[model samples]
Target: MKNFRMRVWWFLCVLPLLSACGGTEVTLGEDEDVAGMKGVVERIPAPYGAGCGIEIPVEASYLPDPGVCGNGICEDGEDMYSCMDCAVCGDGCCAGGERSWNCALDCGSVCGDHFCNGGETAATCRADCAPKLGSVLLQRVRSCRNRFPLPCNSTQTRSEFHWWDDFNVAQDKQKRTYLAQPFNPGRDGVRHLVFIIAGQQDGDMASGLTGQRDGFKDAFRDNDGSMWVGVDGQSLAYRLMAEVYRSPDDTFMGLAFDARFNYGFTPSNKQEIENAYYEWLKEKFYASNLRSIYLAGHSRGGCLAARLGRRFKQDFPQVPLILHIFDGVCHVNDHEFGTNGSGYLNPLMNMNGDWRAYSTNVGAQFPTTQNLAVYNMLSGDQVLGDFADYFVSVHAFSHASPSAVTPSFTEGDWYRQEWFTWTHNGMAHNTVSDALWHYQLSCNRFGC
Candidate 1:
């Protein structure tokens, strides 16, 4: 009871700052002197409209015939020498007949490059090719555990983490969406939970760093680049992880939907993925009587979260839902402008022109792809639709919903820089989400 009183006092004290704060004054981290990182980020011309996060296969050829060995994706037992699409030239390996002349870049010297290459056997180059300490992904994951620790606050007890809709596991073992133990009701006796759907290839809420990956597909995806579980995530737990846990006892769960089924293309895969989330709503989120629910995501995941927010509100009218969108832009073929996403990532790079609007039909002078339909099918998709109790779209890549909070390029210089940095790295997303989560906390506690 004493702890509860202290929490109430803390909430009251924090509410005023949240209600009055704006981007200029919102301090995102313990230290905001990230100018060195920020300076390098701002100068790098950011790549626009990369279809959430999943990098499409080179030339959209991987999915058309994945059964065969020579198809674009390097299948099981296939390597550079065995497949035309696979290339070990830059992988620091001189296998498959690559030598000083044809592959001089790597074969110049295979003795100390950490990979036993060319004709150097394990016996000859034991030091260089010694068996690494652990699995490749494990090592990368270790290296990737950045400043972001699981952000569950010290006051809350977050449940054990086993990523759901298991994108990294065997297919038979995928799509399980329950905690090992049921969530603990807070001091308030509320089973409030936060859920986030990661953008295309972007999955793994606990993958502490950007390049941390789960599989071969991560070659293109900066897994944790959304900054969902970092700095702001640490102090404001109920936003991005069970790690997404809050001090007042609310917690969050993230669905790292690889959307691999989508690629066959990321955009085409979203239809199925979104449908799966609807099931998650029934089977997981709405598992019991929920007091309040928070929904958010980046890119395609953000678009899906907006749509899911509408569904949750409709199904449980008594429950309050808060929806936040982070630069969501979806490009699928369902609508007129929705092009086949199988090639979405490839064609954009080779385009000779800039799209006035987001479209696979690049260079179109006025392609009408910037409709709410592109993101997801939201019922409240008018000029000012109400999808949740509170809806905020920090639209930089593009708008997530056609809701009451109309998005514009004029959201201030703050919004532009946030998304721009979000494009190359997740610094901006971290800051924006940090600021917004605090504001959300204040609002949930005191109706700020």
Candidate 2:
């Protein structure tokens, strides 16, 4: 009860700052663009007709044929296929013959510089890579874990835990009860942190960072990277792991949505999830006099965070919701929303204003030819239209780092690509991770 009183007092003290404080004071003029990582106002393509939309061809070829393999052939009609024999194919069998359609025993395995193996082939291509889907996805998820840690990973101890779908405190339901065995370092206090909402990768929230979290907690005696956890908050935990950041961020937040989609946790579910999260946070820290809350997510999670921010506006509008969407954009059919997503067109004219999705991205080298529909469907989306009034598309690369492969330079910036080519290095996406955080603090530091 005493703790509850402290919380109320803390809320009163912080409420004024949140209600009156604003984000960075960068004036977003009509002609002036929102700044990019470098402080240059971002040049958001004008609305479709206004000159901001890209006229992407709506052809079937752009869609991914995951079932098909090599040079566009799927004769097996049922085999899971993969691309093989590229110079970078790590199997040391790159020069081997007739290796086409063979199982990509090491498709996404990153040994050294190149991304060897793991392409679609005629013989092994199954509809879902049956028996192997879990393995393959798990490997990818681990890769992501290996690369990004600070902004995402945690080294907390474990115990039998349960993920709360919704908080029902009345029933004595610990609401979002997840048994965190506590970190070894045994430190307690709110600290500077970031959250990476995992995408199709990183199924388990508590698995990946167990070891790392321990290290940080031992050293700093606090979860310095903030609190990295999975999205669905279910599963054995370790299955979902992918280092989407070949170009690591100073850190990351893995959401573990790899299997969540299979369930019915749609965009609408975001509000509930976020509410629970905030409630849990307040329950845990507000009384301790913690700092402000800032949230960011990529792809689907990014979309979710954006809407979550809008909802949070009613309570804490001053908090900055820094959302970074890689390839995950939400697209509602014109019939559904009564609008177009392209900036030039009134893509969102009929939109009902319910934009929410989690982070998702297509690898530069591991191009997902099957999920093109998802990207196409969401491209030029206008869901976060006004909600993202202060959004910025940070250091985007043509492809994942090291390989320096460009997906399509016909769109977006030339600087990142140019910077990569000249340096002959994989560009880091997390370079600007702190930029937004720093900017937000600066914006409010002087009472703005």
For candidate 2, lDDT tens digit of each residue in 65-138? 22232223334432221121121223333211112233234222223212234652222332222111121111
Q: Model 2, stretches more than 4 Å misplaced?
A: 1-188, 191-193, 202-271, 318-328, 331-340, 344-448
Q: Write the per-residue lDDT of candidate 1 for residues 1-448, one digit (tens) a residue.
A: 6544433432333323223211112222343223222211111011112221334332221111123433346666655433333545656543333444345455454465555555654456654443321211111110122333543111101221222232232222222121111233442344565554444453443321121233423332222222211122232222332222332334323333333222124443444445555654454444354556666555555556655665665566555555555544443434322333232111222331121123232212122212111111111111112353135211223322222122222221111111222331242134444535433453455331
After aligning candidate 1 to the native by TM-score, how far in Å is the CA of 189 from where it should be? 6.4
Which window of ten consecutive residues has the lowest lDDT sum in model 2?
A: 419-428
Cα shift from native, residue 136, model 2 (Å) = 22
Which candidate leads in TM-score?
A: 1
Error of 2 at 188 (Å): 7.6
lDDT values of the candidates? Answer: 0.34, 0.26
